[model samples]
Target: MGIKRLRYWLSSLTGQVIMVALFALVLIQLVGIQIYRMEREATLGLVNSRFTLQRLVSVTRLLNQSPPALHDEILRASRSETLHLRLETSQPLPDERSARFEHIVRSKLDYPEPLAIHISAEHNPRRVHRPPWMHPHHRPPHHRHPPRPDIRLQGGIELADGRWLNFTSLSDREVPGWSAKAVLSFILLAALLTGLMIWLLQRTTRPLKELAQQAERLGRGDKAEPIAETGPREIRDTLTAFNRMQNRLDRFVSDRTRMLAAISHDLRTPITTLQLRCEFLPDGEDKQKIQQGLKRMEQMLNATLQFAREDGLSEPIRNLDLPSLLQSLCDDLQDNGHDVTLCEPAAVIYRGRPSALRRALQNLLDNGVKYGGKVQVRLATTPEQVQIQIRDFGPGIPEAQQEEVFKPFTRLDSARNLEDGSIGLGLAIARTLIHQHGGTLLLGNHPQGGLLVRITLPH
Candidate 1:
């Protein structure tokens, strides 16, 4: 279940867009941090190099002018916590010169002769200790060391007197901390950008959402309102096509209904003529059979005409009390000596064609009372829909014949009597009306013993 839910969320357009935006933001932030680090390092290196070169020139000039005894005191004055300088009598000359430092120093100096120089760097030990107030459990299992600083400039230049003047100088420039205001500003900018992207996505997709809803209404046999051709060119084109399709469908349905009505009307004249001719015939078994055939034909023509007339979309929809409607229907049937009962009646207001819906429910209740011998009407409502179940106590329909029974003029031999005018159009008309209301009419056998007709309507 968890995996299925996660897949569903990931598949949604909103989730995909958010994920992409988040990834892009992370990538941008990473690149920005890297560029900032590189710039900061370059600036720090340039400043430190200049400071070291100046100190080196000063130390060289001081040694050349002062006596040997004063050299020790002068070197001591230069030493401090951040910088350490000393003069050594015997020290090994470094194998290589610091090319960058040499270039900078030579550019500034105007010495008469070439000066021998060697520069090298030393690594400092990292301080690793927990704060005094920190609990032992909170401390890391393994100590994490801070990053090592850049190498210190430790080398000496040849003095004019040939007395070795070795000195070490270290700069105390630390990397600057990130400003709180800068971090806050970046966070705000990211939030604003994300919101803007979301808004744009919604705007771009709004037409598609509307189109989907309109298509759903069309599928449910409901009248769909024409959507405005707005948004991008592609979206506008799509809406135009949808509107055309809706018009075509409406025209087709209207033409087909009119054709059926015309055919029925045209046939009624001949059927009436045949009935009039049968009245003049002599009374016999053959004549009786002819009359019955004519009567059946007339019944079929009338059913077709009625079906075409109630095309489902012609009815205007309005909010009505569904429970009250069912209760009233059950009361009417009970007055006619039908064993019909309504259970747990509660107020349920729903939007639909009240007259059409009443006819559909009436058909189901009549079927239940006729075939099942007794009718139990139950109404249930949820936040999204209303459901009506008409249950019967008679022998339930066989699974194989349940669907067939809903077709017009289809009758199960044991369940329906042809002589009783059971033309088998009840379930068909009921289902048609229910579907027109954007609802479902389903048939099922009750677990205990009878047939159940379940109707669900969107609220």
Candidate 2:
């Protein structure tokens, strides 16, 4: 698929719904986890800070009560892995960012200058080399470990004798990491929800698909069975309306055909009565004119009745080889001494009313031979439809009357009269039959002097 089409599919209802749901789910999970992590870090930091303050106060009190001679040893004993303590005469500058923390610590300890509080990552211990004057067996350099990037808190507190006691400690972190179990749960939940959404979409759109199929059949004049009203309320209502419309179309066609047939049948009796009245008159030009008029009326009535019967035709559709049908039709004309030529087409299997389609082709072929002399027939298939071209070697129809000939009871030559065996329904009936099969029958004048009848049947 191309990018544009894929993007269009993603913009559909199911795609949007699934995308929104998944986005919301991920957003909620990430936000919730982040909030919990922040709360956990805040609680841990508070407790650790209070505990470190107490330890600092204890060490300071012990140093104050002890003698000056024991100060160095006391400070050395207080030092440990987590806490590094040192004494300096000059006080280090206090960190501006930790002003509130400094005030709290100074108030708790009392009798202190401004305290220094700052946060940073701890650094590795410095490496040292022995001096050249030292003995050959010199003391080994201090052992060093890889530096850690964990948070380290440091502070400076001034004692009563104006000595600064600086201390460093690593921040205690107890926040748990996101686990594999949580990840698996999220994946499984998203999958389940996506599957449920797809199922629901299929159920909702299935009825709509059926409605579209039936609509196509209806356009082709096929009496499709009514679809079962299913799906959501809107879909059910649409199907119901479509079914009612189909029923009404069927009724309308049937009623019109029946009324036409009835009128034509009733007119035949009057035409017969007129024929009897003309026969009783004396043999003269007027008597002959009356008889001829009655005969024309009878011919017109028969043609009308036949046209009505075809209008109400309810033939069953069947699968047939279209090329074979055309070949047989041409062969029949040839056997009957008609000048018919056929260009054999490739095999094409099509589904339609075979009888109706045959009659339509026959009409076109008959017109070409009877009115225009020799007929040339050609059938070919395109990707989308089947085309049949029929041309004759006689005076072609004029441009103005090309479309008019397709109308019922329309004659190309007014002087030809009804005796020529044409009630002008041949083109009309052929076009009607083709239309009923969702095809087209077009009339045009051939450049080489003959009428061209082109028919296209969709695959």
How many steric clashes between backbone atoms does each model show?
0, 0
Cα lDDT of model 2 by residue, 1-459, tens digit: 699787986888778888998999999999999898888866766676666667777888787788878887887677644455777786555343365556666677675344444323223322223222222433334625422313445667777776877776544343566789999999999999899988998898888879988887787777878999999999999999999998998899889888998898788888888888878899999998888777777888888878777742488778989888888898999999998988777678988888899999999998888877799888888778989999997788777778898899999684223336568998899998899888899888898778889999988
Once fitted onto the true fold, the runs of candidate 1 whose alpha carbons sit more than 4 angstroms away are 1-19, 67-83, 92-96, 110-115, 121-148, 161-178, 416-419
Candidate 1 per-residue lDDT over residues 120-198, each given as its tens digit: 6543423323232222344334547423233466676766766556655544335556689878977897888778877
Off by over 4 Å in 2: 1-100, 103-190, 382-384, 393-395, 398-400, 414-419, 445-449
lDDT per prediction? 0.76, 0.76
| Cα-based lDDT at residue 452, candidate 2 | 89
* Model 2 global lDDT (CA atoms, 0 to 1): 0.76
What local lDDT does model 1 show for residue 86?
A: 57
User: lDDT at 372 for candidate 2?
Assistant: 75
